[model samples]
Target: MLNNIGLPGLLLIAVVVLVLFGRGKISSLMGEVGKGITAFKKGVSDGSKDDEDEDKTLADGTAARDVTPEAETDQKKV
Candidate 1:
């Protein structure tokens, strides 16, 4: 039953939708859709970068941590 829609039928449906919602509303809706797709892509890329950083470790087989003031002073005295 769904296969019965020909090009003319699709065009009529599109025309009716356009009439119901003006051109500006449809255009803004499409713009929001585009922004959402872009944000999703960016989030996926950032997540992969974080995973890669976590995989890195020091030569002692322990995970790396941020340097503290005490650790820095001890290293300097040594």
Candidate 2:
């Protein structure tokens, strides 16, 4: 379907976009999308770290809800 449309189809889409949004608004929209992607990645990484900390605490039978630098040494002190 896409291959059949080809360059002329793409140009028509671009023209419609330009007519509807103009260049500056489109650039700003793209920038926001990039920021959203970055923030989404950060959130995913943060969630993974939280999960890892949960697993670590569960495996060790610790009462701490979250891991911290002090928590790392708590086990050593015991």
Candidate 3:
């Protein structure tokens, strides 16, 4: 449905938005959007670094927690 927005149509929309919200308001909104994008990128990179860091403990430099379950006989009656 959005395939029909030509240059003039886009311009008209831009003009309408500019009229509804003045230059200062739009500028501040854009600035906030820029900051949000930057923060999102930073968060994604940090998350990847955290995933890489998870391999920080084995003999081969990778971590693996023990998950072996003990036999029922290993538990004595309380």
RMSD of each: 12.1, 10.5, 7.7
lDDT preference between candidates 2 and 3, better one: 2
> Comparing candidate 1 with candidate 2, which one achieves the higher TM-score?
2
Per-candidate Cα lDDT values, in order, are 0.91, 0.88, 0.87
TM-score of each: 0.65, 0.67, 0.69
Residue pairs clashing, model 2:
none
Model 2 stretches astray by more than 4 angstroms: 1-3, 58-78
Ranking by lDDT: 1, 2, 3
Alpha-carbon lDDT of model 1 = 0.91
lDDT of 1 at 47: 97
lDDT for 17 in candidate 3 is 98
**Per-residue accuracy of model 2 over 1-78 as CA lDDT, tens digit each:** 666898889999999999999999999999999999999999999999999888667666865564468977898899
Residue 23 C-alpha lDDT in model 1: 96
Best by lDDT: 1
lDDT per residue for candidate 3 within 1-78, as digits (tens), equals: 999999999999999999999999999999999999999999999999887677666667767776555664456433
